[model samples]
Target: MNLNSIHNVYFIGIGGIGMSALARYFVANGKLVAGYDKTPSEITDSLRALGVEVHFEDAVSSIPKSCLNSESTLVVYTPAIPQGHLEFEYFKNNNFKILKRSQILGLITENTFCLAVAGTHGKTTTSSILGHLLNECDVPLTAFLGGICENYNSNLILNGTEVSVVEADEFDRSFLTLSPDLACITSMDADHLDIYGDASELKKSFVDFSKRVKPNGKLFVRNGLPIDGITYGIEDDSDYSVQNIKIENGSYVFDVKTPKTLLENLQFNLPGRHNLSNALIALAMAVEYGCPHRQLANALASFKGVKRRFTYQIKTDNFVYIDDYAHHPEEINAVHQAVREMYPNKKVLAVFQPHLFSRTRDFIDDFAKSLSQFDELLLLDIYPARELPIEGVTSAWLLSKIANKNKQLVSKQDLLKKIHESNAQIVLTIGAGDIGEEVKHIKKEFNVAN
Candidate 1:
C-alpha cells in the first residue's frame, strides 16, 4: 500500500480515460512509467509525447526493462481489461505488486484530505467544477477526474498534496476503495446493471459508498436521493439550493442558498438544469471545505466544461452541432431536454450510437422513448465495448421501437454523408462509444460544406 516503495509504474489498459489520468500522475511525480493498450488513441499519443513508453501490443516483451522489478513496479489495470489479459497474467505470475485503478487511487489520497464525487451521471462535471473551484481558491490540491477537464486540458489536475479530489466511480463497486474527508452523490439512477444485476442493488452500492466518508466529514446528496446528508437542488428545500435561475447570453446565471449564506449572480455556461445541479453540488462541497464564495463564483464563471460532455463541435450562424457522451437513458433524456430548450421549434436531427449491447438490452424501450423526442433520428450500430452481442439486441431492433417516423439506421462510414444531406439546421451526435473518434471527421465535413 506504500506508494514510496514503487519505483516503476506500469498499466495494462493505459489508454482508458481514468487509467491515462493515473499514468499522467505517475509521470508527473517523476516515476518511471510505461504501459500497454489495445490500440493507439489521443490519450496514448499524449503519454508518448511525455516520454512515457506506450505500446499497442500486450506482449510481456513490450514491458519496459525498468518496469519489470517486482518490488518497485506497481501494475494497474482497468476493469475493462479482461481477466485473461497476457500482460496482466505475466505480472501476476511474476508476483509484481499490482492493483486495480481504484485501489491505487485510494492509496494516493489516503493521506491527503480527499473530496470524492460519486454518482450515476453527473460525477465528471461536478468533480471538474469542484477541482476548478479549489484551484481558483489557491488550495493545495490534486483532482483525479473521470473526464478531461477542458480548463486544465487534463483529467489529473496537478497540485500540492494537502488535498485531493477524485471521481468516485461505481462500476465494480470501485468507489468503496476510497476514504474521503468530504463527498457528494449527484444521482442514484440504475446503471451498470451488468454488474449490480438490479436497481435496488445499485442503490445499495451507493449507500455503502456514502458510509466511506470519514468521521466528522460531510456527505452532500441531491435532494431526494434517499441518503442522510446535506442536500442540493434547484428550487427545492435542501441545505444547498439554486434560486432565480435565468439564461443570459447563452449562460445560466442563478443565486445559491446555502445553509450559512446566500450567494447571488452565480453564472455557468453549461446547458441543462442537471448541470445547474452539478454546479450547486460543487459549490456546496467547496463551501464546506472553506473556499470563499466570491472565488468559487468566479471559477464557476470561467469553467468551460468537460470534453465530450455536451461538447460543441460546430456552433455557427448557418448550422449548429453538438456531441455528447450520454449512454444511459436518463443522460439521453437530459440531452434531449437541453436541445429542446436551446433550439425549440427548430428542426433537429439526433444521430445516436448506443454504447453497450447489455445496456441496450436493459433499457431498450426507454432509449426508444427518449430518442423519439427529437424531430428526426439516425441511429447507429451499437458499440459493444466489452460485451458480445446479445441475441436479439441491435440498433436496428431498438430503432424499430422508436415512435418517430423519421428514424432510420445508419452506419458510421455513411454518417457524414447522411448528415450533410439532412435539411435540419442542428445536429446531435450522442453516445459513450467510439463515435467520439469520428467527431473530427464530422466537423471537417461540415466545415467544407459550409
Candidate 2:
C-alpha cells in the first residue's frame, strides 16, 4: 500500500486508456515499469516512447526480472483482464502485491486533495476539464483521466502531486474505492447491465459513491438527478446555472450563475449541450475548491476536449466528417442533437457499431429509436467486449427494429463504399469499439481536411 516503497510496477492491460495513464504516472515517478496487453495500440507506443516495457504475449517469461520481487514490485491489472490470464495467474501464485487499477488510483489520491467525477456518463470530459481548470489556476495537482485530453495529448496530467483529479468509474463498482474531498455525479443513466443486472442497482452504486466524499466535502449533481447536492444545469434555477446560451461561429457564448455571482459571456467550443453541462460542473467544482473565477473561465474556453468525443476529422462547407465514442443510446441521441443543431439544413449519415452484446440486448428498442433519427444509418455488427453473444441478438436484428427506412446492416469491408454512395452533406462514425480504429481509414478516404 506504500507506493513510495515500491520500486517497480507492472500492468496487465497497459494499453487501456485508464491503465496507460497509471503506467505513465508510475514511470514519471521513477519506477521501473513493464506490462502486458492483448494488443499494441497508440497508447502502448506512447508508453514505449516513455521507456516503459510493454509486451503483447501473455506468457510469464515476458515479465521483466525486476518485477519478480513480491515486496518491491506491485502489479496493477484492469478488470477487463480475465482471471485465467497467464501473467495474472503468475502474479497471483507468486505472492505478488496485485491490485486492481481502481484500488491503486484510490490509494494514490487518498492522501491528496482529491476531486473525483463519478457517473455513468461524462466522467472523462468532466474530469479532464476539471484538471485543466485547476492546472490553469496554478493549483499543484495530478489528474488521472479516463480518456486522452486533446489539450494535454495524454491522460495523465502531471502539474504537482499535492492534489489529485480522477474519473470515478462505476464499472464493477470501482468508484467505491475513492474517497474524495469534492465529487460530482454528472448522470445516473443505467449502463453496464452485465455488471449491475438492473438499473436500480446502478443507482444504488451512485448513492454509495456520493457517501464516499470526505466530511465537509462538496457533492454536485446535475439539476434533476435523484440525489441531494448543489445542482447545476443549462438554464434553470440551480446552485450553478448557465443562462443566455448562444451559438456564434460554431462555439458557445453563455453566462454562468454561481452561488454568489454571475460569470458573463463565458465561452466553450465543444459542440453539445451535454458538453456544456460538463464544462459547467467542472467549473463549479473548481470554484468550490477555491480556484479563481477568471482563471477557470479562461481555462474552460481553451479546453480542446477528449480525443474521441465529438472529434472533427474533416470540416468543410461542402462536407463534414465527425467521430465520437458514443456507445449508449442516450449518448447517441446527444450526438444527433448536436449534429442537427450545428447543420440543420444538411443531410446526415450515421454509421454505428454497438459496443457490447448485453448492452445491445438490454436497450435494443432505444437504440433503434435513436438511430432512426438520422437521415441514413449503417449498422455494424456488435463488438462483443468481455461477453459472449446471446442467441437471436445481432446487428441485423437491431437494424430490423429500426424504424428508419434508410438503414442498412453493413460489413466493415463495404462501409466506405456505402458511405461514398451517400449524398448526405454530413457523415458520422459513432461507437466505442474497433470502429474508432477505422477513423484513420475513413479520414484517408476523404483525402482532404479543413
Candidate 3:
C-alpha cells in the first residue's frame, strides 16, 4: 500500500487511456515501468518513446525481470483484462502485489486535496476543465484524466502534487475508493447496465460516491439530479447558473450568476450546452476552492477540450468533419444537438460504430431514434469490446429499426466510398471504439479533396 517503497510498476492493459496515464505518472516519478497490452496503440507507442518497456503478447516471459520482485514491484491491472491472462496469473500465483486501477488511483490521491468528478457522462471533459482551471490558478496539482487534454496533449497533468484531480469512474463502482475534498456529479444517467443491472442501482452508486466526500468537503451536482448539493445549470436558477447566452463566431459568450455575484461576458469555445454545463460546474468548484474568479474565467476560455470528444478534424465553409467519442444514446443525442445547432441548414452524414454489444442491445430503440436525426447514416458492426455478441444485436438489426430511410449498414472498407457518395455537407465519425483509428485517414482523404 506504500507507493513510495515500490521500485517498479507493471501494467496488464497499459494501452488503456486511464492505465496509460498511470504509467506516465510512474515514469515521471522515475520508476522502472513495463507492461503488456493485447494490442499496440498510439498510447503504447508514446509510452515506449518514454523508455518504458511494452509488449503485445500475453506470455509471462514478456514481463520485465525487474518487475518480478514481489516486495519492490507493484502490479496493476484493469478489469477489462481477461481473468486467465498469463501475465496476470503469474503475478498472482507468485505472491506479487497486485492492485486494481481504481485502488491505485485512490491510494495516490488520498493524501492530496483531491477533486473528483463522477458521472455516467461528462467525466472527462469536466475533470479536464477543473484540472486546467486549478493549474492555471497556480495550484500545485496532479490530474489524472480519462482522456487526453488538448491543451496539455497528455492525460496525466503533473504541475505539482498538493492537489489532485481525477475522473471518479463509476464502472465497477470504482469511485467509492476515493475520499475527495471536492467532488461533482455532472449527471446520473442510466448507463453501464451490464455492470449495475438497472438504473436505480446506478443512481445509488452516485449517491454512495457523494458520501465519499470528506465531512468538510463540498459536493456539486447538476441542477436536476436527485442529489442535494450546490447546483449548476445553464439559463436557470441554480446555485450557479449562466444567463444571456450568445454564440458569436462559433464561441459561447455568457454571463454567470454565482451565489454571491454576477460575472459577465465569460467566453468558452466548446460547442454544446452539455459542455457549457461542464464548464459551469468546473468554475463553481474552483470558485469554492478559492481560485480567483478572473483567473478561472481565462482558464475556461483557454481549455481546448479532451481529445475525441467532439474533435474537429476538418472545418471549411463548404465541408466539415467531426470525430467524437459518443457511445451512449444520450451522448449521441448531445452530439446531434450540437451539430444541428451549429449548422442548421447543412445536411449531416453520420458514420457511427456502436461500441458494446450489451449497450447496443439495451438501447437499440434509443439509438435508432437518435441516429434518425441525421440526413444520411452509415452503420458499422458493433465493436464488441469485452463481451461476445448477443444473438440478434448486430448493427444491421439496429439499422432496420431506424426510421431513417437514408441509413445503411456498411463495412469499414466500404465506409469511405459510402461517405464520398453522400452529398451531405457535414460529416461525423461517432463512436468509442476503433472508429477513432479511422479519423486520420478520413481527415487526410477529405482534406486532399477539399
lDDT of each: 0.91, 0.94, 0.94
Q: Residue 84, candidate 3: how far off, in angstroms?
A: 0.9
lDDT of 1 by residue, 65-170 (tens): 9998898899998989876889999999999888999999999999999999999999999999999999999999989988989998999888788899999999
Candidate 2 collision pairs: none
Q: Candidate 2: where is the Cα deviation over 4 Å? A: 448-450
Cα lDDT tens digits, model 2, 1-450, are 789999999999999999999999999999999999988889999999999999999999889998999999999999998768989998899899999999999999999999999988889999999999999999999999989999989999999999999999999999999999999999999999899999999999999999999999999999899999999998999999999999999999999999899999999999989999999999999999999888888898999999999999899889899999999999999999999889999999999999999999999999999999999999999998777889999999999899999989899999999999899989999999989999999999886532
Candidate 2 whole-model C-alpha lDDT, 0 to 1? 0.94
Model 3 residue 54 CA deviation in Å: 0.4
Q: Show the colliding residue pairs in model 1.
A: none
Error of 1 at 297 (Å): 1.2
Candidate 1: lDDT of 237? 85
Residues forming the 10-long window of minimal summed lDDT in candidate 1: 337-346
TM-score of each: 0.99, 0.99, 0.99
| Model 3 agreement with the true structure over 191-291: per-residue lDDT tens digits | 89999999999999999999999999999999999999999999998999999999999999999999999999999999999899899999999999999
Q: Which TM-score value belongs to model 2? A: 0.99
State which candidate, 2 or 3, has the greater TM-score: 3
TM-score of 1: 0.99
